[model samples]
Target: MIRVVLTDIEGTTSSLSFVHDVLFPYAEEHIGEFIKNGFSDNPEIQEQLEAVAEESGVSANDLDGLIEVLQTWIREDRKETPLKMLQGMLWEQGYQSGAFRGHVYSDAAEALRSWHDRGLRLYVYSSGSVKAQKLIFGHSECGDLTPYFSGYFDTRVGLKRDPESYRNILDQIGVAPDTVLFLSDVEAELEAAETVGMRTALLVREGPLPETSRPVMRDFDEVDALLRKR
Candidate 1:
């Protein structure tokens, strides 16, 4: 029996346009200013800047250079940890300012609540920072869905496409791999989870379903029904 449900955010429980069109643009527009306005004194920002410096082989004191590199990563949609952390910080500001509420699918929100009430341990595994993941769900259209999650995992654990990352998550969650179900819109991510012996379901919200051995669902309701039958 599946005891845990690990879900992706973008394109899984939420809309991809919100990430690409809304969040990314807001971050790209504000990041340079955010860094310049003395927010760098914040320890979290300092640590992420140090990480950026270490990863990019640049001087941490060169604030302009760091900003340039970060803007480039934002434009490229690079999944670097520092970039994700910075984006998360900016998103926190956006969420607080009411620029937009996180867009979760209606079906996903309903099914998530139902599953949580039914004694399933729900978790989120996304490329976004854990803080950002919480911000999105906490300020969601459905309102404060954060309490439904048992835990959150980000790229800090490891890349989603790396099987070792799923193993690491399984270790952290303290569950047998087969007792956890990984749900993602990305084929490679699902395959990586499967490589670690976890069950997987591909969320095909648009276009034709890909040719793959994994089970496919258009929404979480289908997933819940399918799981019940198993």
Candidate 2:
């Protein structure tokens, strides 16, 4: 029944600890050095640095102070665009250097492949920057799952918890809400998508099921079974 599958990253297709304990820390540790070393030549980083200065009121010349602000944002889990962009660059380096491989659950990798083979259009919707999203799937331990996905959406579209964001994604994807299945571990995000009439599934990869009317899936295997029934 569903033609499109939209998934969240952290706790949905990937483990939460992989993001929190691994990716986030790697970015935090390297952001300053990355900025210091590249600030002179990379216009892309320069632009984001300008954004950082404007948003935080830090002096544009205060590169060291800006680095400190970025480190703070990392610790606070702030969803600043500049922070996400810079982190993506650092992660790209990490991925290319083999410092870390993106984490995707075995079940998720298997099921996503099956869905793609069956002509279900797969997509990613995460708070992470689009670059970061691509880095993870494109350099995954499953050996580059990017081919399975058609598009990606990040906070640039809107906050995940906002219904309008789903509306925007639906508008861009040119799909009816009912024909698209949105999967996420976060109840708020699922509920937001549900508000816009999108099919919603809760991914409880670990722990007991929460109280919700939406279908609760233990893993992508369960999602695959659900797809067959539909």
Candidate 1 global CA lDDT score = 0.92
Segments of candidate 1 deviating more than 4 angstroms: none
Residue clash pairs of candidate 1: none
Cα error, candidate 2, residue 20 (Å): 0.9
Q: Residue-pair clashes per candidate, as listed?
A: 0, 0
Error of 1 at 180 (Å): 0.6
For model 2, where is the 10-residue window of minimal lDDT? 205-214
Q: Encode model 1's per-residue lDDT on 176-201: one tens digit a residue.
A: 99999999999999989999899999
Which pairs, if any, clash in model 2?
Answer: none
- lDDT string for model 2 (1-230, tens) is 79999999999999999999998899889898999999999999999999999999999999999998999999888989889989998999999999999999989999989999999999999989999999999999898899999999999999999999999999999999999999999999998999999998999988878888889999998899898888
Q: Local error of candidate 1 at 40, Å?
A: 5.0
